[model samples]
Target: MDISGAGALVTGAASGIGAAVARRLAAEGAHVVVADMQEEKGRELAAEIGGVFVRVDVTETDQIGEAVAEATRTAPLRAVVNSAGIGGAQRTIGRDGTLGSAHDLAAFSRIIAINLIGTFDVVRQAATAMSTNEPDANGQRGAIVNMASVAAFDGQIGQAAYSASKGGVVGMTLPVARDLSASGIRLNTVAPGLIDTPIYGEGREAEEFKAQLGSHVLFPKRLGLPEELASVVLEFLRNDYLNAETVRVDGGIRMPPR
Candidate 1:
């Protein structure tokens, strides 16, 4: 689990929690790969952190392979953070209850493809590469951290697609970790509550909206910061004893179904 002088890949590193995780890994002396779809921002962050940026769409196998290959070129790939995902909110049936009131099948499928299947693809490739790495004293070759959401547990109304996708991520953590155990690769998931990120638009109105959302937190009365989540991610990677666990970074908030 010693990532120093090794390489790390972080998907969705263009911004938000993924960006924070990428920077943290770089600061820890890992050759980080900023894998993301946003070329400009990904490149910018890569340059800022003295890492490489690979334009990757997790759903595409070729693109993910390229990113993993790039990460391991200079150093052994020891850390991977699967943070690339999208959000979709649609009920099985709209209030109208008309013929077309059902949730859009394509939208639901897209979320699953990206959040669930995409995550597994990256993990599989990353593990394959890590399996070739020389193990440490504890026979640990690498560590993986996957991003989930509190919605996976406390899904609200209209969050069918988003919740299902994240739920799948959480559901697979233990089994995937078991499968990777022999290779000395560990897998864990972080289920985050509301974290302040670019997904929320910038402006005074946006601040007000976020505040209303934060009011629900049990303490501190604010949304979590991306860095806060990033810190936990590092722990998961560095703590060799941690595996097959889903830790919630929420501030003691159990979301209410709206």
Candidate 2:
């Protein structure tokens, strides 16, 4: 799919990898819709990139639908990047082996809701909008890129909820691609490792954590940048043949059990 001059929606575009992807896509000439819950940051980024900001909470179906509508309102809906997600750390059982202190079901459900179901909802709605678009020369209407985590495959301790949520994303790739193939839309996923993002905190604490995590990385022995992840996302969106795939942008690091 040719991303230039198309309507692209990126969820969680307020910061981190999503923000980076939005900037890159805009640079590629796509009219980006920065959809995020952070009004101030989302609006700022959108303005910086000459794009529009749509305040959207991916878990809210109505908000996502509205966002999709706004994104496609002025141009053909061609690309969607599902980057909105939350992270949590909780063991299945507590140290005292008490059910009351174990992982909270509500927290687990929230993670799944935001990371897994929310991604699916965005894809479903975006694909629907893209289906109405006239197909390009390659019979492609649009492309979708979803965010997962290395935790999905190599989850450490205290990551049950996060891992399960991201695992759902990885599991859905093939089936979703097949389902959307007939509609001329493609689906894929990106599983990032320990990237240098705000989620890891700031200053000395973040540096220390990065060092510890970097030790596990096979080469370069350092954290990845958001731009690196965004580059992979661009590849997934540009390459028409790369469908139903989940690429890990982890710098060859398979997380160890904690």
Candidate 3:
């Protein structure tokens, strides 16, 4: 996709990875929509990126529809980055000491709703707009990037809901790619390990965590920088052939059992 003058929608754009992706897309000359529930932050982020801000609660399909429609109406929709998600430490057993997600259905349902379902909502809508576009000379259309996590593969103790949400994202890559093939749109996922993002904290002591993560990687032992993730993201856009695979931006972090 030619990012220049193209439009993009990024969920969870108020902070962290989503914010980074949004800023980067704007820098690349894409008209970006900062979709987030936090209106104040969303507005500020939009100002910073010189993009539009759409107040959205990704868990609701109606809000997703409104955001996408509004963004598409303004600019040429070419890319979508699904980055809205939550993380927490909750065991399969609820605080009530019950077993299975069935025992804590509400909690599990919320996680899946905001993460997996929300991601799909944006992707579906973005792809719809992308397909409507007249393809480029090579029949290329658009790109959708789904944010997953290493937890999808090596979830530790008490990571049940968050892990399951991300696992679904990882699981959907191939099917989504196949479904979008006819439209000439590409789909891929990015499973980031630990990163130096606000989801942790701005600049706390990361040495111990870096050391722990280094043991799992073949390269430098460190939490990935947001730029690292952005690099891969831009690379995916540049290489139209890349699709249906989840790129691990982690520095070999297999995650230790907690």
Give the poorly placed runs of model 3, Cα more than 4 Å off.
94-103, 202-218
**What order do candidates take by lDDT, descending?**
1, 2, 3
Ranked by TM-score, the better of candidates 1 and 3 is 1
Please, what is the whole-model Cα lDDT of each candidate in the order they appear?
0.96, 0.95, 0.85
Residue 12 of model 3, lDDT score? 88
What lDDT tens digits, residue by residue, belong to model 1 across residues 162-249? 9999999999999999999999999999999999999999999999999999999998789999999999999999998999999999
lDDT, candidate 1, equals 0.96
| Clash-forming residue pairs, model 3 | none
Better of 1 and 2 by lDDT: 1
Candidate 1 to native Cα RMSD, angstroms? 0.7
**On residues 122-224, what C-alpha lDDT tens digit does candidate 3 reach at each position?**
8987898889988887798889899999999999988888899999999999999999999999999999988777655433466555556556665676667
Q: After superposition, how far is residue 136 of candidate 3 from its true place, in Å?
A: 0.7
Error of 3 at 138 (Å): 1.3
* 169-203: candidate 2 lDDT, tens digit per residue: 99999999999999999999999998888888889
